[model samples]
Target: MMLSGVVSAFEKVLIPVAGRISSNRYLLAMRDSFSTILPFMIVGSFFGIIEWVVIDPTGTVMGPNGMGLGMKMTGLTGEAYLASAFVATLKSLQALCNLVVTIGFGVLSLFLVAAFSYRLGGIWGGDKFSTALTGIGAFLIVTPQQVNKVGGFSLDYFGNKGVLAALLVATVSSWVFVKLTKNKKIRIHMPDTVPPAVAQSFAVLVPVLFTLGGFALFAALLTWFDIPPLNDLIYKVIQAPLMGFSQGMGFSLLYQFIIWLFWWFGIHGHNVTAAIQNTVYMPAQLANQDGTASYIFSNGFFEAGLMHIMGLVIAVFLFSKKESWRAVAKLGAPAMLFNIQEPLAFGLPIVLNPILLVPYILAPLANTFVGWLAVSSGLVPIFRFVVPWTMPLFFCGTIGTGSIMGGLLQVVWLAMDVFIYAPFVIAANRIDDEINEE
Candidate 1:
């Protein structure tokens, strides 16, 4: 009788504390932004680069073999040393591949910035490598007004160098923002109604206006004045704020649009996710020149895999509320075994929940940081192995990072999710209780 009384006393304390922790509004906001906005921005930028810089140059040619096929199929043979069909094809292929890889590197750098900013609460001081690259890229892209010209030799034309100058400028801008706002919390005020017309307007107008304005200003400055490096400065200052604003606005609007579409179709956004994965994400893996096979696990296994685990665990604990726990159990059981969570996401209504959002976002960002640290510190091998996306989290981590340490880190993420969500579940139960009472 004494032991039963003690257990009851503990439960009373535990429930309320869990409820309070789960109700943290700031954490919920952060999670919502990270989940709904960050992923889309990253993916959209990637696709933009691919469309603008990559596919424009290469058409359907994937690699050297594709180029060779074009040459052979055209039935054009010439002097091997001269501008032969093979040589032209090779040159085109090389140029295309280089452009793709370089743009990919730039996109990856941007992603790092975005990830770091989110992790650091929407602020990131530039790192040395990223900053320097951004500077060089910006200087090249933004042409300054030429001064003291001997004859007509001005370095104010847009070229490959301009792209580098733009990058550099972006880096510096990010660094400056970080330094200025490090101590302050960023206030994000999202509007309630995001109408389709408004969303579409912003989506088209924002990027176009900013990008064009940046280039035009740089060109005007170069033509009117004799400033040599003015273009670089202009580029740097413009890139960060423009990129951030455009990306943030576009992603939020796009997400809402997608949600609406899903509702109309009576389907979840999983189909969209699958299409993106199959096309954009998977094709990127094939960019590696090495003979190693490319796979879905290459890009997303660690992040998505752990989410599945966390979702399942949370679903298990929250089961008593709706008797949805049994459904969660049934679906989550197979998914958790294979490290997939589409069922949980759709079934559990975790997409827009204020409570679960925190863990959903924080867990992945935290895991990514940990994984990066481990790889950088040589605690784990750089993942070179290719595994299918369908692989379980533990095995995915092991193969993706090429170390058992990655798997261990995944476990840490799973633990974090439990801690993060347990309180949420408890809070949700309390709310349910209040509703029942009412």
Candidate 2:
């Protein structure tokens, strides 16, 4: 009873805090704006399959070890019939991936800026299209574009590395634009004869001018002071510290707890934490592709594969006549195998069902901590590759770490979650029984 009381008290305290955070406009904008990065990354992960499975030398891939269909085609790479065609295909695929990365990770600023401004436009009754354009202009205006001697501008200033600057520039600039343009006097009134499009464009003119001019002056100030560009300055002063803190073991529990807690409340935990993920973990995941990464908590570390073996686990052992559980297990089986958990998340109904909440929230954290300790103790190889979360368990882990033991580790965590959730499942069944009896 006391333990239950303590939990109730904890929830009472936690709910209000989570509510405020989930409702905050700034954080919401950040979360929603950054949400698309994952999809972009997911698309890019398919490209990863091509490079690692097709182009890589035979027997080089760690996990999926049958014949690579892509590698087999390499025989066509000889000059006999047309090696040029094979090479062209490979180059084309690579170029597609390169553009995805360049746009998705490199100039992610555009999405964030556009989303934030679009959102602000709705909130402040301004023109959404104009606000979006102004936000993009403001971000570009404040950013110190670095041009090489060859007349090429480096895209680094616009990529994931520039996220913080993008957030600041977009959020503040859009707010400024919306706030000023909202005034009736600041907008240019067009006669009924004028086209609606021209009138709307004219309406945003003053706010766009002031907002962009402010950024231009800020850039000039940095230029005069001879400091690094805005992105570099913000990265050094703001993002660098957060990145260091997030990559540490000390922050793992707190981070995972906040994320899962959000999940328990029916929120997309990843969305709420998107800003941090891009600034901290995503960078490490990108670095791991080069095979020199030392981080344990890269992209695939907290993947759905970490929980993949759970559906079969419950279907086979945990329940006996619980039709709902059985149905969810069967329904979620296909998706879970791919490490996509929406079926399990909603079908099993982990959200807001207090009976399953304990294990639902704690399981991922337990897996993460254990994975960290395993890597630290050298019990398993550290993951130095970004395995797409959509990959199945043993494969995701092994491919991620390039070690069979890592695959086994994922299985082990699945078993551990089964054990953790068993008692809760029984308790929930008993509660259901009581209600049914009544």
Candidate 3:
């Protein structure tokens, strides 16, 4: 009775807490903002593939570490591979693609600023478009504008470096703009004869000025401290420590613990844990792009691609006698290719079922271990690309890691998980058979 009471109270506390976090506005805005631009990021990945295989065959993707997937594909040998990969025809194509990636990822902060500004701005009854634009202006005001040695204007500040600044600016600026504009005393009131668009633009002009002025002051304070740019300040002070916490085998164990614990209790674990992802893993991925090499477990690593395929293999070969498992196997096969497991999780009914927990939890950890080992041992390239969450199994692995070995390792892990799940599958099948016979 005491144990039952404890369990009851635990559920009472956990459920509401999870629900509240899952519905949090800032977290939702960050998630939706990412979701909005994820497609363009994926398009950028295609260009990254070209750059990896065609423009620069010298890197980890197809260099000695990757066993030369690009070299084999193009049938180019020695200096020929390096020389021809960037020949004029391919050079132009690569240049165009790189520009797209720069626009996609290099100015990722801009997209995020626009997206979250629009999202948070709607709450204050603001004009979403104007508020979003003003958020960009405020972000630019705060960032340091630099000129390169070649006399070219540079704004690397608008790229991954500024993600944290962009998030805060977008939310604060848009909210502030809305508050100031909605006040009758401050807002410009045009006569009824004026067109709505022109009047709305003029109405926002005062609010935009105030928002930019506030940011300019914020920038000055940072400069007073001799701080590097705002992005560097954010990276050193906030993102760096959070990212440090996200590293190591222990972090993976802890993250897996949270993800599964919530998932077992019927909460969407990732949705609630979105804040950690935005703060830690997302920065880790961007840092990976900026030449940092040690980040083996970013969002890309946690997003396992073929774990579902392994489940299907276990269901088919081992659980043939269990009609329910087989039914779920067929239904889950498609979603599995896309890395979604909800159908199997609910339909196979793994949640809260003691019989299935061992395999359910173990499969992902097994996959993670195998993948981490492969990357750490240099048998596969560390995944540096932004993998779209819903991309299919092999494609996700290849595109994400920029190596054929990465895709093959996913297949290897898929097979390993099937073997791991085999005993539990057999046990479940036997129980089903016994029940049917009875």
Candidate 4:
């Protein structure tokens, strides 16, 4: 009864807070914007694995001895015509892969600006096209055009470094556009006979122009003061620090705890936390992909390493004396293999169930610590690929890290998690028996 009271109190406070955070317009815009580019990011990382790790003779997989697949198969060494041609072919393929990655991950912030404004426009009832253009213009206006002797709009502000600035510019630009269009006095009302497409374009023109011009003036002021571009400033002052803190074990542990805590109260913890996770950890994932930095924890870590629900299913199936628990495990086992735990979460009644709460939360945290240790100790490579949430257990880790050691690490974590849940399942059987006798 006391446990139930405590659960009710926590639920009262947390459900409302999580709901508000999850439903916030700006955060939704940020989440959807990042989501819009996720497929492209995955495509880039897939080819990046091929370009940097799979084929290159100097890569970790191929070794520094120049004995690549083609060389080994053809029984040829340096300077031979066939070997030289193969090497040239490999280089060409690498260049092509690099092109794909460049167009995708290379201009991530550019996509974010357009996507964020488009989503925000929908939320604000603005014309999506015009609002997106204004957002992009605002971003470009506040971004540096020259970098490292590159004259045209620099690539420096188009990648992960410009992510936060892109979101900021998109929000401000979309707000201005929405507000201006709503003002009847300033709106360019077209004739009733005019086509809707043409009329809509003309109607949004003033809003787009003024919003972009405002950013242009802001950019000019920064230049006059000899200040760095807004992208650089935000990266230095905000994004970098947040990214650093997110990579720490303390932050990962707290985040894991909060996620399960929300889950225990029947909230979709992952969706509720998506906004902050995408905003902070995603940049570190990009940096790791680019090999500019090493961050052991990333968005991929959750899907690949820390989702230990399958472990509980196994423990229940193998060790639980309770028939109800085994039945839920049987039904939930297949879905859990694919990393979906909703069936078990509700069926096993993980929500508000005092017996299961400790293991439900503790398993993921334990997996996180072990996963972090494995990656940091160089036993498993840092996660670079963004594995789909539906990716199966062992393969998720392997594909995410682009190494077999990652799969082994997942197995290790799974075994540990199973043990964690086993004892709890036995305890639950005892409690059930006691209730029956009473």
Q: Against the correct fold, how does model 4 do in TM-score?
A: 0.66
Estimate, for each residue in 245-337, the C-alpha lDDT of model 1 and write its tens digit.
321334323433453333222232332233233333333344321436433222443333345345436545654365665566576666555
Q: Candidate 2: global Cα-lDDT?
A: 0.67
Give the TM-score of each candidate: 0.36, 0.75, 0.65, 0.66
Q: Could you arrange the candidates by TM-score from highest to lowest?
A: 2, 4, 3, 1
In model 2, the runs with Cα more than 4 Å from the true position are: 1-42, 51-88, 100-106, 149-153, 157-159, 238-248, 258-360, 421-438
Ranking by lDDT: 4, 3, 2, 1
lDDT by residue (tens digit), candidate 2, 114-193: 87777777666777778788888887777665566665456766665655666677778777888888788888999989
Question: Per-residue CA lDDT of candidate 3, range 385-407, in tens?
Answer: 77656666666677678788878
Whole-model Cα lDDT per candidate?
Answer: 0.44, 0.67, 0.70, 0.76
Worst 10 residues of 2 by lDDT: 55-64
Q: After superposition, how far is residue 190 of candidate 1 from its true place, in Å?
A: 53
Cα miss at 129, model 3 (Å)?
1.0
The total number of steric clashes, by the backbone 3 Å criterion, in model 3 comes to 0
